[model samples]
Target: MITYQLSKPVEHGGHTYQNLSFRAPETGDLIAAEQFKGQISQTVAMLAMMSDVPLPAFKRVPLRELYQIMELTKDFLGNALATTGD
Candidate 1:
């Protein structure tokens, strides 16, 4: 398991946020990016569903789209890590 810590509080609108974090489990031999992406996407989708938000109309969701989402997630994680570097 890969764990990262926040060095500073996340702030918005002049207020500090707490407990904001991300975690990714590293498998034994393979870092399957697609699997991570799918996990994130499904989690988001589930949250949206719980909140009664309508999902987008995609004729066919492809693996490429999932990969793209994963890449975006990786970039986001990288930025967060950089901001809270040790």
Candidate 2:
């Protein structure tokens, strides 16, 4: 698991989030993310799945933070992919 503190808290769906914790993505998460039409939408869905957060909640994140989250997700997934090739 990976945990990241938010630069600022975000309120969504009656909950306030101070941080995001993500588990490694599963096969279902990957398939679900692919359903999105664009790379941005796919990445957002993937992040939501990995973090176990609802899609709408990500919209509340600051853009700068969101980019960081995207990089985090990408790096973790990339590392996973690299290992699986062995």
Candidate 3:
């Protein structure tokens, strides 16, 4: 597992939430997420799946916020990959 402090938080239904904790995704995770195929919603969905937080909470996140969240996920995963050599 790897944790990162989110520079930005995601809000949904008047609730604010963030996950600084995530699991290193497996190759299967990549294959599972591939159906999203460059779509932001699916990318966010993948990040939510990787996070320690409950995935349903992110379902309501605004589309505008997904890019930033995706960037954070990318950075976290990249750093995780570098450190773990997985």
Candidate 4:
């Protein structure tokens, strides 16, 4: 597993969180990514499924941070680039 520490903690509503970790993709993760067509949903789901994080956690992340994390892990086994916008 590869672990990444967020530059700063993220705040959503009244909660704050830090750090994210994910492992290399397995066959199941790939299959799930294939099943989702929406770019954002698919990306977040892929990340959540591959990582220790839950889906709600990704939803709480700021867009810039989310993009950075996804880009940083783009070539990672479980983290595919599924962006629809720049």
Best by TM-score: 2
**lDDT ranking from best candidate downward:** 2, 4, 3, 1
lDDT of 1 by residue, 1-86 (tens): 22222344444445443322323423321232222245445433432232222334111223454344345446434432222212
Instruction: Show the colliding residue pairs in model 2.
Output: none
Best by lDDT: 2
Residue 60 lDDT in candidate 1: 23
lDDT scores of the candidates, listed in order: 0.33, 0.77, 0.57, 0.69
For model 2, residues 1-86, the per-residue Cα lDDT tens digits are 88889988888889888889988888887778777776667777878889888889877788888888877777667643332211
- Model 3 agreement with the true structure over 7-78: per-residue lDDT tens digits: 467666566676446676666655555555455544655677787454567665555555555665685455
Better of 1 and 2 by TM-score: 2
Clashing residue pairs for model 1: none
Q: What's the TM-score of each model vs. the native?
A: 0.24, 0.82, 0.49, 0.68
Worst 10 residues of 4 by lDDT: 77-86
lDDT score at residue 60, model 2, on the 0-100 scale: 78
Clashes of 3: 0
**How far out, in Å, is residue 11 in model 3?**
9.1
Encode model 4's per-residue lDDT on 52-82: one tens digit a residue: 5666776777788778877777778433443
Clashes of each: 0, 0, 0, 0
* Segments in model 4 whose C-alpha atoms lie over 4 Å from true places: 7-16, 77-86
Residue pairs clashing in model 3 are none
Task: Evaluate candidate 4 by giving its C-alpha RMSD to the native, one decimal.
Answer: 4.3
